[model samples]
Target chain A: MAEWVEACAAEDIDEEDVVRFDHAGRTYAIYRSPDDEFFVTDGLCTHEKVHLADGLVMDDIIECPKHNGRFNYKTGEAKGAPVCVNLKTYPARVEDGRVMVELD
Target chain B: MNETLPGMVIIGAGECGARAAFALREEGYAGPVTLIGAERHLPYERPPLSKDALAAEAPGIRTIAEADRFEAADIRLMLSCEVAAIDRAARAVRLGDGTALPYSRLLLATGARPRRLPPAEGSKHCLYLRTHDDAGEIARRLRPDARILIIGGGFIGLELAAAARLRGSAVTVLETQSRLLARAVPANIAEIVQAEHERQGVRVLLNAGILELGERGGAAVFRIDQPGNDAGSGPTEIEADTVIVGIGAVPNVELAEAAGLAVDNGICVDACLRTADRAIFAAGDCCSFPLEIYGGRRVRLEAWRNAQEQGALAARNMLETDEAHASVPWFWSDQYGLTLQIAGLPDEGAAVVRRDLGEGAFILFHLAADGRLVAASGIGPGNAVARDIRLAEMLIARRAAPAADKLAAAETKLKSLLAA
Candidate 1:
């Protein structure tokens, strides 16, 4: 069953930035792109299980804080070396002022 | 491809060498790739040896790639193997087992070995860490009732101290210098690290010289001398259940030098990581290459990222693509709950601007005499300083002259400074 969960207020995350959201014992990273679009992915980096929200976000890529493993938050594609596994992404939408993500 | 061609042969199967092997395949080279390692286990990460590996309930190797990955990539993974000689003229490497393998191109990634302390050479209670086996031995000795004495206050030593403390062992660090991390980090940041270790119950002794190291009563003992002591007081002795030497590492350049390759601090290589011989190249801790970002200054980096990047770069050059080594130097150390990160060479800076983040996190932006950002060092809890330090690394690579006020101001985003 698919369910929608409220992550945070859309304004909580700055443009081109990401925030961590926990729901039902699961961690997710909520990103606010420069164009005001919302995106979400698993909070932990696939490389070392580090929090992706603590990493730097530029454009659509999130660089891991520990080892600089890069991933495209929107598409969940690993950029290159040190990270060969892709991150799992979730569909995110802004409903009113709240950011909601679909969880399966 | 010629059936007789042996393809790409990598000498060392550590991070750099293994990465190079895979990189060669990734670059669409269909040639045969053989990766050789002296260690019994597959290529594993060395960084965690002093950190998580030590703190783990059961220590184990963190391999860079699994056996299946190597098999899938068609990389011939040879472990517990040793190369006796490099037949440069014949373009073949002779193994210790007397088997000779020919290669189209050879990579020397022999890496480095821990510098030995003469006095502790044969002491049963003294140990040095550089491999998975070494980490296992050290981990076993870090028991709750053990007294751990770490020699040298460098990154390896301090990290070991933190790990020992976490294991409930009483830890003490000895350094000949006046402060910890004097070689790389600024004193201010180093002080914070020392403070954290002290808070974690690890005793840090600076300006302490080791007169001798020997085993006494089945324990390691060190005779130390301090400058401020009375003249006739002589040297004092300290005993510990185990002693770990983290002094430094020396590049394994003997093989390269004997093979008639140019050797300075390490195997000398051009910007593209190729040695004087066109058919041979070196990277990682084994080679000292010119840094294009620092006006072609020749330097050898031992950091993990450097090893990985240089490995891939060497692979590209091996495939006939010319690419100069242009990345800024970056290093990080974690102790207790704090992490210290440094980007670029701090010695190049003539001025420093401080930027404070809340909760005791701050960054020191080092500027050259001409006002260009040369380096950035930060110490904080968790990943508090990673984002800015990374942005500062980009700025350093660009040789940006960011304004001091803007750099010192917390409100000014370092990412915006990148745009400027």
Candidate 2:
């Protein structure tokens, strides 16, 4: 079953940036797209388990800080070499100035 | 002569050669691809050998891709195989097993081997790390009661020291130069690294000259002279259970040289990573190619990212895509809780502007005489400076001339400057 959980304030993360959130002993990354839309995915890089929050976000893509592994955060698709495993994405929305992610 | 069709042949199976093999398939070259490796294991990542591989409870090889991935890609892997000579006239490489493999195009990614200390050769107490098996041997000696002595204060030596300290081993580092990472990083960054190592209970001796190295009572013993010591005091002797030599690496260019390819500090290649023979090319630590972004200055980088990028580039050029290598030079090292990242060549800078990111985290932006951004170096705990350093790399690639005031101000977004 999926449950909606409050992650952070909608304004906490800058536009075109990502922030890390921990809940129920699981790590997650919340992204605010350049258009102000919210998205969420597993926090660690699939390649090296590196924190995705430290990575740079350009549009919908996130580049790993350690090895430059790239992934499309919006669709959970790995972009290229050094990273073949795709990230797991979650349903995200903003309500009452709070970002909510559906976590199972 | 071999009966098999000669599609694409790669001479080495390290990160560079392995990546090139796959990259060829990705570029829609639906032809036969063969990757030959001297090692028995599959192609693995080397960066972890000095850090994570040493610190792990049960260290194992971190391969670039699994064996099944290779099978699915239809890439032929020839492991534990050595190419005896490159028969250029016949366009075939003769293997040590007396087999000849021909190729339409060839890539030499033989990489490099550790420079062995003359005195420590064949000594069981002295070890050098260049492969997975080497890391396993070093890990066995990193117990709590063990004493570790590291020679050379370069990235490999410093990282090993950090790993040893984490495992509760007593570690000491010796550097012939006045500072650590003298050739790779600036003095300011080197000081931070040295301090971090000291904080972790690692002894660092700079300007320490090695007098002799020998085994006594099954322990590695070293006699060293400290620069500030009295003349009559003589040399000080240090003993350790294990002595690791991380002096440096020499490119494996003998094969290329013997095949009549130009060899400078490394195998000489053009901007497109191709040798004088259009059918043959070289990449990774084995090849020294001109940097187009730096006005055709030739440099040989032994970095992970460089190897991957160059491998893919070589694959493209091998298929006659004719793409010049234009990426800026980038490197990173992690020790204790601090991470140091450098983008572009710092030596090219005529001046520097410092940017503070709070909590002892900062970045130094290097500018040329004409105020063009040349490099950016940052050191901080975790990934405090990763984003900015990445942005700085882009600016340097664009040859941007952002104002120093804007660069020094932490409030100014480096991404915004990219749009400008």
Candidate 3:
């Protein structure tokens, strides 16, 4: 695994906005919830692998606009029909006054 | 019938009917309520008929009884009386016998029946499954070594094949389409399922046609017409000791139609599951209402969850409050040790998203043109999709927006929950 990269500064997105960042040639959806919470997970719905970056993000939950399936952004757990898998989550941290994730 | 809304009366003691009764009580209606059932059993769960009852999947998958149970819930259960007619003018329902029950509100939860195969000249040994009693009979007559020929690769047919294989029977599934489960899943997605079932020793015949289902030497032999090549495109034949037909279902609509209610492929209903006649409400398989998912398209769903949830929602709206029917359609099927689940409703023109697949587990999501959730199917991942669908449905109620991040966390936890 590669060393963790400071992919994006914490201020890069709105609280409810989900932005895509790349590290180690992999894509991730870095979510900054409306409550100023920071979370990172594989940027896709686990069930159909639809990129979560393109899904509907609510409070702490994101719904795959594709099938309206949902997942908890914090734990990356998928909720809804046509989905029963979990989003791969990367441990998220707020360090150096910025959102930092150990993405290898 | 003229003055005040008649007391609510629900026909059929299935899960929908029972839930309607409970929901009415929950709705705080002080008027008289009655439940008429054709089956003698209390509103027992019917999903087991296709799964546990046939494969012995669970020790006691009996019908659920809440704390109020039947007695405590004050549900007037009328067992073994099939409603034969609905006198809409008089605001009364006529039973098979000479009894007529007058009601101010009537819920037609008269479910569906299996579609029979085309008739042949001679007698053919065929079987179909729907009710608990149907499952019981099939279970009793199931022979471990019997070879089974099943028509229709739909959920019910595939489920029965899975059960039959589990019970030590040789199973062969035939589908007229190029892929199995064509109606439920995208073609490419269905390929994965077909492959899985095949890996488990199921004989899957696709792009094959059946001239007829007839009896030959006491066995059901399906005459096949293959489509790919000259050699395979001729009239071929397959034989089995037992034949199971699952070509889909026809909604039981005689009573609803005869009652002068709006009837299409199923009983027509508005946002509140109300038929043309305001006095009647229909739920479960017998009715089709405007579904928000298919872009306000009217569709009929026969899955057990759709039956139960919609039935309850309709009940709650009809008796208790003036709430609209907002039940999101959901369904699950177990086949070849794989559990498939769905959330939302799907039609012909949706896009398919292939999520994940490992060791015969994965998911297929159906998305609409604008990417609004239309339908999804979880294989080995059904539980998550099922739950997310439910949660999304609630969000739809609030007409609120969803945070993509929260859904990701929920998705992460779902895998563990499903395994547990």
Candidate 4:
């Protein structure tokens, strides 16, 4: 059985912005798109493997911060130089107001 | 674009080859594109082989293209096939399996191999990290307590030293020059790296040249000599469980030259990357073309970015875009988490200016003649102030156009320098 972990307070994230949360020995980046939709991906840059939590989030894309490689926040597909690996995206759900992640 | 006449057959499906292919497609040429590789893996960045591959836990490896998606773009990838010979006269190529494929054009992206030691090589302790396999094997051998001796202190030698020390290895960098990265970078910049390496407890011995390579007690030994010191100084020997040679690379121009192309330090290609024959082109580590910054001298560049960019441009030219590939050469190496970026070319006597020389320390070397920004190098990329910085040296035969005009003039020179 997997756990429905409380990741972060939904109100903590500003619109079209991102916030990172730690839970159950795991770290996840929570983002709110310009359209108010929410998504999360593995918090790491595909190039140089830097943590994506520290990367730049721009225009529905998470720039790896290092080498400037990017990935779609929605699909996790890699875009740009230096990184070719598609980012591993994590699915998320929102409660009445708090953001939650299902961890297996 | 009518599949542009004389389709190109590029060998060695790596950064150079893939760039050429993508450039061709992006230029709207529905031509026949054949990308051949001796390795089965899709074209992956190779610079990391000596650095990141050794530190898999650390990241920054980005593949310039989609791995599986290359085929979707109709790139004829002949992977895992050895290129036997290039039949230039017939305008075709032969694989190791004896398959003759004709082409109206050819690109010898047949990248170079690591310059190895003697065939009957003595010790198994010696190493080189030019390929992924080489890096993987070296990575496994890297131990904190291991005594690692790097034969050359060029970028690879110094980079490996940094990585090995990070893993707690007793690292010693042996460079024949009095300063590190002497030929590649200016003496002062080399001194900075040397000081930093020494600060990190890396034993950097400059002007201490290696006489020969041999083994004693399962360890590699480098017979040492310091020039102009004395004759009876006797050869001092240093032993290491592991030794990596970075003496430099020998261009893989045999095939291109044997095919009747003008060969220099690399395959002699023009500004258009066209070889002696218009139908053939060359780029990357195996080719050397004229560099305006180096006083129109032809020199070889083995930088990662140059390989990829040149590959793309070669492909574009092989198609219909007849644009000259004159991008200012830029290269960077990452080690100890410090990003070292160099733009343009610097030769002996080129003036240097230290920008922010602290944690954000980046010194820009301005190689100017009659006050024009002939070459600009720093921890970052080029600066449009090249003409000003370069022009400052004008009185000493280094002055040129005014610095103010280089940028504020609202001219295209700024745009072109920025592109490089």
Candidate 5:
């Protein structure tokens, strides 16, 4: 079963920032890139399970708050060292005035 | 097509060498790539050795390029092969087995070796952790209730201490210096790290000298001398199951030095990462390159990021395009669930502005005399300060001078200041 839930209001996350979204019991990091693009990935870093929501979002890359390892927010590809695994990115979209993420 | 391409031989199969090999192919280079490593295993990551490897959590190759990646890229890896000398005149390196591999361009990423304590001051049980094998040996002996005596309070020692504590082992760290990480970090930051270790049940003894190491009653013992402590009026004895020496590393510059290459702390390279001979280039811990950002001061960084960047740049420069390498040097250390990261070189006597994010989260921004951001360190929970460091790195690279008040304000977003 697939579900699309409203994570937050579109304006809730400022540009180049991230917000933590909890759907049911799962956590995801909803990011807003500098170009006003929306992305969502697993909330924690693949390196040490640190929250990616608290990390820095630059362009389309999210620099992990722990170890400064990086991940491409859109595709969830790891960008640098100390991080090997790709992040699990979620399908995100902005509908009307709300940011929604698809969970299956 | 492969035979027509130029031959590129990289000397070390560590992180830097592996990245260089992949980067070469990624950068549109159609070349016969040969990667030679002295270690028997394929190229693996070294940073996790002191962390997970020491704790016996995971005991396998933490690889940068898996065997399949190298195969797909057609990068030939020669393992367990020792290069005896660099025959510059012949444009080749002669291996110990008398195999001479010729190269049009060569990259020396020989890395470094751990500085060992003299035999007289070290016992049979004394061990040093640098390679995967060393980490495995230490992990095997890190049994519960094992008393682990770690010498030196540097990153390796502290990381070992954290792993030992997690394994239910008693860890005692001995530092000859007055404070922990005295050489790497500022005194104020060192205090916090020392406190964190102590809080986590690691006994950190600063300003203690090791007189000798010996075996007694099936356990290793260290005789120490403390300058002012009454407990060490003469010599104090500390016993442990094993003595792990995490002193420091000496750059592996023997081949470069013997080859008559410019050698200081490491193989000297220009800003473009090319050695005295244009055909030969060096990077990683083995090479000292000019830091244009710091006024051409030669620096050899052992950090993973530096090695990866330098190795790629050296390869690029060898490809006929000389792009000046410029990026703020960055490094991060993980100990006791705390992430300590620093970006840029902290200038001497630089003014520091501190911001407390509350709940033991803090970020320190270092500014030079001219008011440009020189460096930034973040010691927050789960590396909440990494963003601050990234912005600081940008500011330093641009030589931007923002108002001091904006830097210290809690509500100010680091990236917003860049708009000006």
Candidate 6:
């Protein structure tokens, strides 16, 4: 079963910005890459409990604010040191100026 | 001709050695790689030894690569092996077990060991946090209501103190210096860190002299003297069931030095991490290389980032590609729910501009007289300065002298400055 939830207005997220999307008490970090692509990932860093939405998004990578460890925005793969586990990615798309993510 | 291929041999299978091997494979070097380490456990990260591992958190132990990954990568990992001597003439290293491994290029990643306290012997319950076994022993002693005494006020000691306090252990830190992290951080930063520990119910004693360690009723007792008061004239006592000594580390340069390689405070290597002998190279905490970003001052960093970056860089350099270890030094410490990330070396006489982001969050930029950002440190619970502090590293790299006002202004977007 696919449940698509409208996270936020796509226009609300600026280039290279990340926003926390909360629905039914579950949180996800939706990011707008520098390339203007939208992607959604598990909100918190696996290394620590810090939220990835509060991290720094540069180009296609999101640097965890807690440790400066980075993750690939599109695939949610841990790309740098201090972070070993991969971030779970969700199916995300922009429809009619709104960012929608598919969750199970 | 020797039947074995003349491949790369890396000594000391810590983060640096292990990562160098993996980087070599990733960089398309398919030669026979041999990774040797003194410790019996597979190469694991040392940073967590004082953090999550100490706390007995979800992630029990961490390895840079999985055990099977070595086999998949065709990298031979030799555990519990000690390299006794390096025969530069023969282009081989002799292990303690009397096996000589030949290599075309060698990397000395034999990191560092904990510096033992003076008169280190005779303490029944003293411990040093360095290896997996050490962490396990320390964790076992950190039972609830256990009294733990830490000997130094450095990063490792403080981290252990935080973990102990988390486990309901009574923590007490004794610092011979007047402040915490005296050598590493500035006075203001130390004050904040000390305050955080104190607030967490950890008794911190600064400017206290440790006279001796003795045991009474199955407990370790520390004799101390307090400076600047009558207490200095008399020896006082603090007792604990367990004592952890987090006094710094000493570089394992004996093998390199014995091999007649250039050795100073650490193994001396060039910008390419190549030692005096072109066949040999060194990186990570064990080697001192020129830090061009900081005016070519030779520095050996013990941070996890430095080890991984330098290790990979050294591998590339060994593959005959010239790569300089010029990345700005960066490190972070998580304590009492606070993450302090610092980038670059704050030079002496550098002007510091600070911005308070309310609710105990702030960012500081250290700039030269010409206003070139030299370093930046951010402390906050909510990712306050991590993003912006990286900008400072870039500015430092480019030698960009942005105005101090631009750096201090909360409204200023650091990324925008990158374009300019």
Q: Estimate each model's TM-score.
A: 0.97, 0.98, 0.72, 0.74, 0.94, 0.94
The ten-residue window of minimal lDDT in model 1 chain B covers: B227-236
Per-residue error (Å), model 3, residue B120: 5.9
RMSD of 6: 2.3
lDDT order, best first, reads 2, 1, 6, 5, 3, 4
For model 5, residues A8-76, the per-residue Cα lDDT tens digits are 998999998998888888788999988898988989888868888877887888988656789999999
Poorest 10 consecutive residues of model 5 chain B by lDDT? B228-237
lDDT score, candidate 5: 0.84
Write the residue-wise lDDT of candidate 1 on B1-420 in tens digits.
453677899999999999999999889999889999999999999999999999965698888989999999999988999999999999999999999889999999999999998878888888999999999999998999999999999999999999999999999998889999999899999999998899999878778878887777888889898775466354477899999999989999987898999998899999999999999999999899888877888888889999999999999999999888889999999888898899998988999999999899999999999999999999999999999999999999999999999999999999899987
- The ten-residue window of minimal lDDT in model 2 chain B covers B226-235
> Pairs clashing in candidate 5?
none
Tens digit of lDDT per residue, candidate 4, span B1-420? 234344668887878888788777767877788888887666777877777677753344435566566777778778788887888778888878887888887888977776765621556888877666677777877787789988788888888998888878898888777678876776766776777788888887777866777788878877787874456463477888898878788888877776777887899988778887888889998998886445567878887767877888788777756756666666666667555655566663344444443344454546455445544444422222222222222211322333533433333333233323
Fraction of native contacts, model 5? 0.56
- Report the error of model 6 at residue B374, Å: 0.6
| Prediction-by-prediction clash tally | 0, 0, 58, 25, 0, 0
TM-score of 4: 0.74
Q: Model 6: residues >4 Å from true position, as ranges?
A: A46-50, A77-86, A95-97, B1-3, B57-59, B229-235
Identify the candidate with maximal DockQ. 2
Off by over 4 Å in 3: A1-104, B1-6, B56-61, B66-68, B120-124, B233-235, B348-354, B357-360, B381-420
Model 2, residue A79: distance off in Å is: 0.3
- Report per-candidate DockQ: 0.81, 0.87, 0.03, 0.07, 0.55, 0.57
Q: Which stretches of candidate 1 lie over 4 Å from their true place?
A: B1-4, B228-235
Docking class of 6: medium
Q: List the residue pairs that clash in candidate 6.
A: none
Of 2 and 4, which scores higher on DockQ? 2
Note the chain A TM-score of all models in turn. 0.98, 0.98, 0.85, 0.86, 0.95, 0.94
Predicted structure 3, TM vs. truth: 0.72
